[model samples]
Target: MVKHGISLVEAARRLGVSQSTLYIALQKGQIPTFRRDGRTVVSSGALRDYQTGKRPPCAYRL
Candidate 1:
């Protein structure tokens, strides 16, 4: 169980990927994200929603 609103790095960690990999996916739009105070972020709610089929699966390969 993860808390809501975590950093991109932590999101990558939870998904078992390197920060660089996540960044690459982000750059390619293979992953979802939002800006917060000018910082890249991945909300846990989004992740959870994704897991529950709320969002499409990422084409990113780690």
Candidate 2:
């Protein structure tokens, strides 16, 4: 059974990225996540928004 939210591995697979890459994205705040039951969770809406380009990638202003 699928959980309320998706695991980082699943999200990475859907995004065609590696788990570590997703982890880095999480750490860098490129992708949003929240804690649920002591595990990091990403919402489907957020994933969809990312896929559809509704959310921009993290940019560093120097």
Give the root-mean-square deviation of each candidate in angstroms.
Answer: 5.4, 4.0
Pick by TM-score: which candidate is best? 2
lDDT of 1: 0.70
TM-score of each: 0.59, 0.72
lDDT of 2 by residue, 1-62 (tens): 45588888899999999898777767766677877799999988788887887765666321
Tell me how far candidate 1 lies from the true structure as C-alpha RMSD in angstroms: 5.4
Q: What is candidate 1's lDDT per residue for 1-62, written digit by digit as tens? A: 53346798788888788888777766655557877777778877666764565665565554
Clashes of each: 0, 0
For candidate 2, which ten residues in a row score worst on lDDT?
53-62
Q: What is the lDDT of candidate 2?
A: 0.79
Residue 19, model 1: Cα distance from true site in angstroms:
0.7
Worst 10 residues of 1 by lDDT: 53-62
Model 1 regions more than 4 Å off: 1-4, 48-62
Instruction: Give the Cα-based TM-score of candidate 2 against the true structure.
Output: 0.72
